[model samples]
Target: MKLLGIDLGSREVKVVVMENQEVSQQFKVSTMSFYRDYCNFTGKIVVDLKKLGVEDADIKISTGYGKNNTDLEEFETINELKAHVYGVFYQTELKNFVLLDVGGQDVKVVRVEKGLITDLELNEKCAASCGRYLENMAEVLEVPLTELAEYSQDPVELNSTCAVFSESELIGQIAEGAKLERLCAGVNYSMYKRLDPLLTKFKGKRLVISGGVAQNKAIRDYLKQDYEEVISLAEPQFNGAIGCCYYGQLTGEAENRE
Candidate 1:
């Protein structure tokens, strides 16, 4: 059986398909383009699976930022937190760990014990702690995001608490002739600083990071100071969508058993 999962993220839409409980295909599209080209408004925005190019799934599940608010036709909606947790469970097969999912617009830190969620913290109010901050910093530096994520030592000090102001501060550092590596490290470290407070209470030996920021090596390096093990998902960005697919497969199997 084919299971389809769609994660309607703030910046992009992630799509994943699982065939016989294994990932068969995965891709992402800009949210704007996805809504414009692959969806039609029938009083409410309705996703056209044909236009999405994956219409042959036996089951479909939806998650992410728009899951709660967007009413999708011919799809079942799941909470973003639940989907993320399930995705980690499926990918890592670990029952106890701290899950940190930093998205384009927000951050989610969940504490899972014995495969169940015990506590979770969210940082939806600040862009400084999210993936968008790193994107903007990379843009200001005229560097690729991947390159920007490679620096983790001797970071320059960026004191701004706001995401917008931090960009201006980064430009000032450039004018001061700061080393490129230091500037990059500064941006990455600044993000870690913002995340530190949210993570202070969730004490765990292992941390499973998901979402776009999981690819940031510099931030991951900083995170190593707090946890003994910091593991990144193989498909970090597609985790939510993958979780939806896994959830569908699990539920489908249970129904068949019954």
Candidate 2:
């Protein structure tokens, strides 16, 4: 059967096509480009699935920040955290794990045990703990995002909790001749510290991460300290959409892929 999942995120839109219980194709597009060119805002903005290389799906699902605003009458809508948990479970056999999704504007932590969601935490009130903070820090350090994620073991202790002040602090560190790597590491570590409260709530032996920041090596390595291991999907950014597809199949609403 074929299932199509679309995640209408803040910065980007992620789409996944699943056939025979496997991800057949996946892609992402900038949210602005999608809305300006593809979305048809008659009553609600209708996403053009065909433009996303999807057509004639047996079942379709939508999720993320913009899910509620979509004009997909036939597509089912799922909560972001629920979709994230389902996606993680579908990609692995693990029944117990702490899921952390660090996106552009928010961070989400979900605790799942024995195929059920037990507890979850979200940090939407601050950008300091999210991917955007890292991006700004990287810009301030004059290094690529990949390079900035390289140093986390030993950090310079960025004390400011506000995203704007943190950037100013990083610039001050630069003027004071702190090593570039150290400054970058400080940014990474600071984000980890901001996430401490959420991580403390969901205690588990395993941690699974997804979303934009899942590719960060420094953050992933630091996260290992709290859990025995930290895991991520092959397509971490598309996990939520993929989970939506998995949910469609489980509900017996999907038919053969044609």
> For every model in order, what is the number of clashing pairs?
0, 0
TM-score of each: 0.97, 0.94
Question: lDDT of model 2 at residue 250?
Answer: 82
* Strongest candidate by TM-score: 1
Clash pairs (backbone) in predicted model 1: none
Model 2: per-residue lDDT, tens digit, 33-79?
A: 87887777766667677776788998888888754565465678888
True-vs-predicted CA distance for residue 147, candidate 1, Å: 0.4
Ten residues in sequence with the least summed lDDT for candidate 2: 249-258
Worst 10 residues of 1 by lDDT: 64-73
**Distance (Å) between predicted and true CA of 139, model 2?**
1.3
